[model samples]
Target: MASDMPNWFAILQAQSYSAGGTVPLQCETSATYIAKVIRKVQNQGYAFISPSHEATADFNDVVSRFFDDKVLSESCNSWVKMGPGRSRNLVWWPGTAHRMEISRDPRWEDFVFGRAKETRVNRVAYFGNGWTERERVGGVESITNYLKEAGKGDLATLHEAWNE
Candidate 1:
């Protein structure tokens, strides 16, 4: 595991917005932006770790090293609350046509460190005014999949987007 939080975390979070359904075309563009961030991180070698014995241990370790318990509280934010009982969503915005969250019991670790396997994290289409109701974005996999065919120049754009 990484000894410290990656510098990109703040950059991405700064660019992230919590209110969904307000900005024009935010859903798709935000997804693209977040996917670019995820792809950038993956390029650095981290994988998405779903909830499990392994995830628990990893979450504990990451929190111990990175999260400040004093700063985190039971979030009443609808975005934070809209997920599996145990899992937590971090990068999602209404525009991306997807609902992405850590695939485990609610914890803030993945919010900071990301996860273990590329697919270990959960990604699904979201509908309505961002109430966490899931609808399908047919034939689409994760948002990151959108970049699978991206060329070097495309990646360079993403690097610029994330200041990488």
Candidate 2:
């Protein structure tokens, strides 16, 4: 266990501290806590990546000492990929707009249904125009037809269209 151990493992053992518990710190609960701590540290590192506002430079310096250059670079890239866009409404129009225009525009349902089908892999679908009994029924029927045509057989079929 000593001679064949990896450098990090040896370092961990040398620097290991007791938690005053009967069981070791490698227990499931302890492991989960450690994982949460690591994630928090990573998020903190990401928060300092591109200083949009004041105080970011100070925070970046604090996180840079613990995380290596490669790790920091990767963290910065991940943050950029996951961060919200500068424009909010430009990316995704609200569902209310779909409902309002569904009756007036013949192509509204087609556009909404098509996009929903496309997002099946990501498990995202738009279910607009379900305001009233008649509208809700129409919405359900349209979605059902769209799903059936898309070959989504395993999806739970909605029978009472208006109620839900």
lDDT of each: 0.38, 0.30
lDDT of 1 by residue, 1-164 (tens): 12233432232332233343344444444455455556644554444422344554664555444322322223444454334443334443322333233211234343444444543443211122443212245233433333545454465456444322
Error of 1 at 32 (Å): 2.5
- Off by more than 4 A, model 2: 1-12, 17-19, 25-30, 45-164
Error of 2 at 109 (Å): 54
RMSD for each of the candidates: 16.8, 22.7
TM-score of each: 0.22, 0.16
Candidate 1 wrongly placed segments (more than 4 Å): 1-24, 49-111, 114-164
Expressed as tens digits, the lDDT of each residue in 20-75 for candidate 2 is 32234324333443344334324222211111223333433433432323332343
